[model samples]
Target: MAAGRAEETTLARLPGYLTHVALSFVKPDLIYQGGLDLSATGLQYPYSGTVLKEAIALLKARQPQLRVLLSVGGATYHGWDRLDEAALARLVRDLGADGVDIDFEPTDPRCVPVDGRMRCADDALSIDIARRLRAALPRPHVISAAGWSVGAYGEGAFADAPPRSPWRGAMLALLRSPAAEGLDLVSIMSYDAGPSYRPDQAFRAYRAIWKGPLALGFAVLPPANGGPRATIESTAATLSAVLADPKAGAMLYALRDVPPGPPGPDNPDYRSLATLICVTLDKPGCDVPMP
Candidate 1:
């Protein structure tokens, strides 16, 4: 189960709580560090030092075998331009993390290029950072990024526009870069495309451009209206359809919205969604199976 938020104070306490939750309720083999937004550095989202330390300590204590990664950048952060190789190396060394997740959205308006033409600086910064992190870290660290929807990007829409679509060509360029050589995964924000969006659309998008490991991210809340369950069924169906294609798995945008149901070793909705993939792909640790 990938956590969405982790601060310095909460990081230390997370390992134990996660372990207890996993052991007692749902045992996820992998957990993504919620995130430490770089753009939030000095803003309202000032970086949390305690969260980072506690997160590291928790991984060391409760789930050493569990893969723990740090997600850098987010919807609001766009300071990737300032991250050089040296700084990235230091970050990896200090954090003792296994990998980094880049979720920077270019359309945030805050990322507007001073000279226009959507500068490649952000992409370059990410590649350099990935290279440095891989070199400094002894273990194979992961480099992941989240992209926009295919239709939106393919159609040539503005970056911040609704559906702020993913540019397939742009993404492919990043994947092919020297720095991306160490990239282990890529998660696509498949939600909010439109009410008519289908799972096949996502599959076709990835099949057309990506040849690496992929994970689909679905939102539990509606794109415009904050509601529930709009994603669970579709997410499960999408997982069932794509599990056989070397796709890693699916991730719910959040755990908080997961519906409340039977109180056992599993939440039926989560279990069912996870089961569809495990059964189809035969992934042992994809998720904790239903009883």
Candidate 2:
């Protein structure tokens, strides 16, 4: 049996609860290239920039235990090979943010079924950097990874009704690696796989090894991203079902970016979903919406 299903998650080792809802996507490439004031770009990254610091300060003020993480990638992100982990940690510290969410979406090393197992070319990079991140920012500072929907389809052990996704096993290395212990959370990018992938099932597959705070992510993305459109009803059903697990969490892909799709706007979404997550698990701080 996969450990995520069989093993009783050690609550003590994992976070007490996933407190922060994770305001995302502070583009590492831009920060790496020096983009302290993204607000200057005028409509590039509104949630980020100098305002991001204020956001963090406000979140912390609301709940001293809250952790505001700076998400670092998106669907079109690149240049994982060159990410300076040290600089990233420093940036997190500088921003007054609690930690970093390594949202890596590399194009290469797409894992393939190989020799009764799955393998990717540079799979080690995921955990290697995770370990580095954990080392750089120890306890109380959270480190999480955003996983691909069908990223854990190895033939044996890790297998769990694999979906027909563009990249299979792309994230298995990180989850299965020993370094995964260094991570505090792993949010599954459970959308964007079209009809073949079910968000709930993807969450189940990941539960096999990721015994920590495993979040089932929701997205309000554009049609250009190429996925079945998300309705509040669907998002509600998925979160309601998956969040039944005590360790399961709710994560929105973006609450700030003007997602180019209908119903992407945050009105009923922020209200309903945030309320649902709060009421369901009794997680505090849902009163203030995600930024």
Candidate 3:
């Protein structure tokens, strides 16, 4: 699964290896408030029917195997008690997307309610959202979540790892809960981990909790100049690790971050990374000429 934050047309521009492409976000506020905002004004990136349709159609034509999902929630929070499952279902149908991805990050300051309530801290709320989405969407649709890195839960960290926080059990609650059984993928955001850790270590931390297929999330770009991150070579190694495990998967941070040009001398890292994903995953167009 690739968290696709670029223009939908970006799908057409790249060689396709992604089994799933999650559109960056659709706002928890909209889902929780009632319905699609429709208006372009208040939203950060307003929904665009034309862009979506073109992106969906192009991807289908270019790579029939790829599944698209509307990712909801990020670093923002309004006082939405719950998501409108019916509306989400309708949107899924309208956009021809296969499913939804829950990306609620409670620890972020944005998720904190204005009233200083702990609603975002409620573990059951995340599970409830997942359950509702599973029930509302038809069968065979994908449901995934961008989960916290194991370090956030104090499970894995290196000597130089970023500041650590206790798991607080919210993320674990989602994974260990019965609701997770319906989940197709739980991508552990493995970036920003201590530099010494291997991808398998991060993968294991989540696997220990979430009883489902797991995707190790990695970053194409490092977060800061000196923090832990994967190079092109390390990324290839991680992808190989994912291939060796039956229950494992790999998720790149975003498609847009890759250089627009073909993977080559100027953009060798992106090209090599993309090639590894395409060939390793056996996606269509891998054998075709690089775009």
Candidate 4:
């Protein structure tokens, strides 16, 4: 429901409903300058390189349960020291993406509370960059991680906020250790991190440190450096209390964003929070339209 941006192509006019389309930044200096410019990726698709793989082959020839992922350190995450790993697994196997979304927001190990709990600083190089990008792209090819909406504040009852962030626990020091078994899902950018964020307690503090599938991040603009985000009736009351647990879902930092600020409900875009996440994931169309 979230994993927004990828220019939201909205998949070119809300293609029914998205499954996973995260084509944001691949910055780490373009995976240490091994390749890609794609003739400057789209702002709103005027077309680029081989017509951008012919619009990703007309979007998997029309949403064959779309899965395109190629994001890396997007919206944040400075540098996790280094992760070349065969040039980011050869740019996710030369842009035929379906994996890699490690949005690790590292700036320099901060989160220090020590004795009272919470302590961080690279946590073993962020769990060895999620176990070296899942051993350089293995299993089904997906690795998500955009978490850090107050990295589930200092444990023990999420130890009450305010810890002077540098992405505080930085995705709770890589999904509370064991490198989160190299992830399969995690998206919690829960809007600007001010106005006291509480997207269902940042999804119950990252579902108390990763338990597989989890999304819950939404923001169709508003919060460059101004607090208070998430509207549309608090994103439908936090996606109906976090998707009523059917392996919850929702992540929208962009879907052709620009929905303005100050209680973001002027609604001129982001198709009313992607039709309120297609009527809270009842799925099927949810009145698609909006080109």
Best by lDDT: 4
Which parts of model 2 have CA positions greater than 4 angstroms off?
1-18, 21-23, 26-51, 157-162, 222-227, 257-272, 279-291
Question: TM-score of the candidate numbered 3?
Answer: 0.75
Q: Candidate 4: which stretches are off by over 4 Å?
A: 1-15, 22-58, 63-67, 70-84, 87-95, 103-118, 121-124, 127-144, 148-152, 155-168, 172-186, 189-199, 203-236, 240-276, 281-284, 287-291
lDDT string for model 2 (1-291, tens) is: 012321121111123234664545555544442445554111243244455555555546645766777776665656566666666676677668788888778766667777767788768877777887788889889888888877766545546464554477878778888889889888888876766667887787788767888888776563345656666666767787886688898776554334543343232343445455565556655554443
RMSD of each: 9.0, 9.4, 6.5, 15.1
User: For model 4, which pairs clash?
Assistant: 1-251, 2-250, 2-251, 2-252, 3-251, 9-12, 77-105
- Provide the overall lDDT of each model, using Cα atoms, as 2-decimal numbers: 0.47, 0.64, 0.62, 0.68
Q: Give per-residue CA lDDT, model 1, range 43-137, as digits (tens).
A: 22223434454566565665565454555556554555554434443454455655556565555222222332232434565456566556654
Model 1 regions lying over 4 Å from their true place: 1-52, 108-139, 151-168, 225-229, 256-291
- Evaluated at residue 211, the lDDT of candidate 1 is 69
Write down the TM-score for model 1.
Answer: 0.60
Please provide TM-scores, in order, for all candidate models, with all chains considered together: 0.60, 0.78, 0.75, 0.34
Off by over 4 Å in 3: 1-8, 31-47, 77-82, 108-120, 151-163, 167-170, 196-198, 258-271, 280-291
Q: 1-291, model 3: which lDDT tens digit per residue?
A: 222432434555545566787776665545422233334212333335545555677777777878888887765643236567777666677667789888876654222222322223566687888888899985798888888664324332322233333332236657767988878888877766555555676566666666677888767665554555565666767777767667777787765466444555334444455666666665566765433
Of candidate 4, the 10-residue stretch with the lowest lDDT total is 40-49
| TM-score of model number 2 | 0.78
Q: Write model 4 residue lDDT over 142-172, tens digit each, in one string.
A: 8888877887677677777553466665666
Q: Please say which candidate is ahead in TM-score: 1 or 3.
A: 3
Estimate candidate 1's alpha-carbon lDDT, on a 0 to 1 scale: 0.47
